[model samples]
Target chain A: MEKFGTLTAIAAAYPKVNVDTDLIIRVERCAGTPREALGPWAFEMVRYRPDGSEDPGFVFNREPWREAKILVAGENFGTGSSREMAVWALARMGLRCVIAPSFGEIFFGNCLQNGLLAIRLPADEVRRLMALASAPASATFTVDLARQTINGTTRFEISPRPKRMLLEGLDELGLTLAMEPEIAAFQAMDRPRRPWIYL
Target chain B: MGRSLFEKLWDLHVIAELGDGMQLLHVDRHILNELSGSRAQLDNAKRSLKPRHPQLTLGVADHVVPTEPGRAGDKTPWAKNVMQIFRDESRRDGILLLDVNDPDQGIEHVIGPESGFTLPGTLLVCGDSHTCTNGALGALAWGIGSSEVCHVLATQTIVQPKPRSMRARFEGALPPGVTAKDLMLALIGKYGTTGALGHAVEYAGAAIRELEIEGRMTLCNLSIEFGAKIGMVAPDEKTYAYLKGRRHAPQGALWDQALAHWRTLPSDPDARFDREVALDCSGLVPQVTWGTSPEDVIGVDGRIPDLKPEALAYMGLSPGQPLAGTRIDRVFIGSCTNSRLSDLRAAAAIARGRRVAAHVEAWVVPGSMRVKREAEAEGLHEVFRAAGFQWREPGCSMCVGANGDLVGPGERCVSTSNRNFVGRQGPGARTHLASPATAAACAVAGEITDARTL
Candidate 1:
């Protein structure tokens, strides 16, 4: 997993709300392809034409924005589908962070697990960022995980464990094993209490 | 203080609080499917982490399996490999696997309940988001990521923060012809997709209680679409009766004990939730999506919503345009959300004497092989076939655009699946989500139409 500390990159603005996983990466695109090949197909529906030509007018395909490593999207970004391939597609597409007013629960979890920063800010701040992102001259934004701030526009909130995980590059496997003793103790007591569940 | 079901379920499974609201929660049951589980992950973990409780876990092959018989199975190398991986790993790990030919094979959510692997008052986790479908039985179930899957396989536990609780209480009765899918879409339409973000939602009140176990599952299955990881319904006599005599359910004396425990799973009268919303389903009508998101829905009789320019362009809809006469190119009636016997029966009834329109391609993929066999025994297959709908094998087919089943580019489809997001059915395909009956009606009409009118 990539350790996320700080990132400074051009941000692209996509103001469409409910940018679901299906829009991010189609199920068929993710089905048989290698994870690495998913980047080019990210947002393929809007990004390309039926003839496979790029849609020059789409936000991600526009100048400066095409090189953007940060995405400022509308609220409820990443709703629908639990496929982590959505996050993989974004990260593989060179996006290190996604800023939105809100996000789907599973998508938020997937972002953190895959070492991508998902920042939630006030709607006003998101709108402001969206404007800045759309204007190429002010498209650059910096995300500082240590300070829990984005472009110094707002103090973001991320749970401490996730913050630590991002900083240290620790995955859940190691952390879960650290609590094995406690898990065993709970199971010992729970087994007899819910015997029917075991069978 | 009285406890809500969420509180009770969370407190019961917490192994340790890792600070910052995170906890190591024991997973009583973990389910794996081809979409989420892979041979590579399991093979890598085997070097250090053997499945601690193989008996508590089961493997399901659903995602990439061919829903049609005798096709090159290798249509997509990626899918074929993943399916093989699931089979190889499950056998090596000594985990019970329901392969394509297995009579018990089906979508994980459907098989979980029908096979009795999902029980009330236990915690269940799967790698797919719709794992919440199992929560209808009063179980505390939610979807987890692959890393969490590996953790559960190694320790039978997952580390996570407990989510805040929210409840949507549905008052009044749904009008005839409206199903759980309609109620869910209506709720999503009202609240938007992010309405339940960061919280576990409990479906309660008169309307929820009135639903049968299958209906309840359909409601919870789409909870993920509403941005909630968990969607639950407290168990009742309906739940108990549904689970009785299932292969994995407790028998006789054990059943009695289980029943006694389940009776205590509902939220106490005075229990509190962090958030609450009430939706009255008094006159709710069948719903269909006009835009990509599930939240972008309207009643069948209503006009397309005034959505943003981008959505309108993508969906090929104009503001206030009547949604009824929109042409449809395909109709899909399968997915964990609405592929059960009742769903099939509802669609079959609509297609009993009608024929699919020449311009429309229609398919009915049953939720499970068991469901397929039963539907065939009842001659449901003949109804669909007689109406020009292809009756296929049990699995996630057009729902996820896998298994070589896909809607052509720029084609319009009315689907019973949970999502209608861009490219969900295929690249450049426009999907409008509806209930099985509505989809069946659309197939016959060659356009989006109200099932009630038929």
Candidate 2:
């Protein structure tokens, strides 16, 4: 488990808007069992076709994004459906961060839990990064999680909430469990007041 | 920056800032169901805590409960556990509990608006993402986490930052064969899901005005699919007329005051938005998910995408596929998303006296007991049963896999509920999203086809 508010990583740009969880993690590949789906089937829904062949036209299928750490995307990235598989798939695909103009509600939550940093950047800024990534084969960008900034040879920074949970790899349950000491104190202090809640 | 529905409600309700970015904002209403019982309510009970705003909280047992009239709980241990917990906890908190046998019991999202608990120009919160259904009534609503639920129970509020505002104006009459469900599916196909993220979405235009309260609610319910947590339509004469005599709608002098406030809730006529998308209702068709996701959709007559290598690698799908004529073994014509009276009517209209195809197995699940009774009175249930479709009790069966209604592996189905993500129906089951009418036609044809052509 690791937590860093800000860390610089090489960027990968996916400019298509409204990319869904099905594409992020395919249900077919992730099928077999709950535990198996956790690792591979995350985006099985969107990534594969009926005949079980790959759609080469997909943005992530392209060479530029195949192995990049940061995915800079267009408006509404990760929209539609509430499956957490999308987040798990992207994270498992070795994506550490995703910088988009926006994100779907469920996808955003799943991303935070599965440890994929979903960054909401401005449309203009998103386009700027897309241009930089498409400019040269070797072109790259840097993402700073602590400051919520995306910078590269193209310098641009945007500040949003610096929620420390994702950086520290603590999900909702993790955060609640992390407060054990404080919760224990609160419970121990007033056992007589609320007997039904505690043993 | 543009703020989405989440931003508007967050800004309006934020009362104080705590350590870090954690800020507390008022929670006007709290909605809960049986599915979230263990992680949320039961967990909260361990603290011997009481809701800070019991008056604002309401719990209903819908998910994981048998919809049969005499059935107190589902036949399964997992479902029974949660239903019992929901009942006991609501009694303990003195909050309103709509039990499975109670006439009020139904999908929380559907019942909220019908009971007028979710009205125009109010802030609403629930543990379900589709909680955005309140937006149809001109309220700002979104889903919260279990911890957030606990926080709201304890403090009457949860932390918030802000969101950008966006407006999606859908104009023109949605021509015949299209519905709010179809329109929302189209929007997701176009906007790519995250289109409304971190922003409040105000759905306006001629088409929006023409929709019924339930239809409007269905549209708002899918806001989360486009990355927006809150989706609202401003209250108007239509809104006023629908609420005239609802169980909890304002009455007496309170009615006038509520209308006065609702009249001002819409964004200014010329108000600027951070992002804007305009949709034309003239050319849309019946929507259906061809693959494993909602956005992996095609029209009734369309074909699947010419996928790429990366997509194939990610999903194990092949390119150059025809979505049409795909064999389907099942049709589920109900769920919280589209199991209203209209949905039943649409499906029944086709199923009436028409036998389902030899191989097509179908189930028509009502969203609630109220819908079931209504359909029964109208003979919709009889039509389904006659057509060889299973007429089951109300609950969210086949929508989520908590119930015993899992679509068999390697089988294909047409479902009316939202979300076409993989395994959502069952392991290795391929679910194609469609409206109820379309689902019925598929059941009759035993393959992917159009309702109009039926």
State TM-scores per candidate.
0.96, 0.75
Query: Least accurate stretch of 10 residues (summed lDDT) in model 2 chain B?
Result: B308-317
lDDT string for model 1 (A150-172, tens) is 88756899888899999988887
TM-score of chain A of each: 0.96, 0.69
Tens-digit per-residue lDDT, B240-278, candidate 1: 999999988899889998899888879999999999998
lDDT of 2 at B411: 77
Give Cα-based local distance difference scores for all models: 0.88, 0.69
Highest DockQ against the true fold, candidate: 1
Model 1: DockQ score:
0.71
- Per lDDT, the best of the predicted structures is 1
DockQ of 2: 0.12
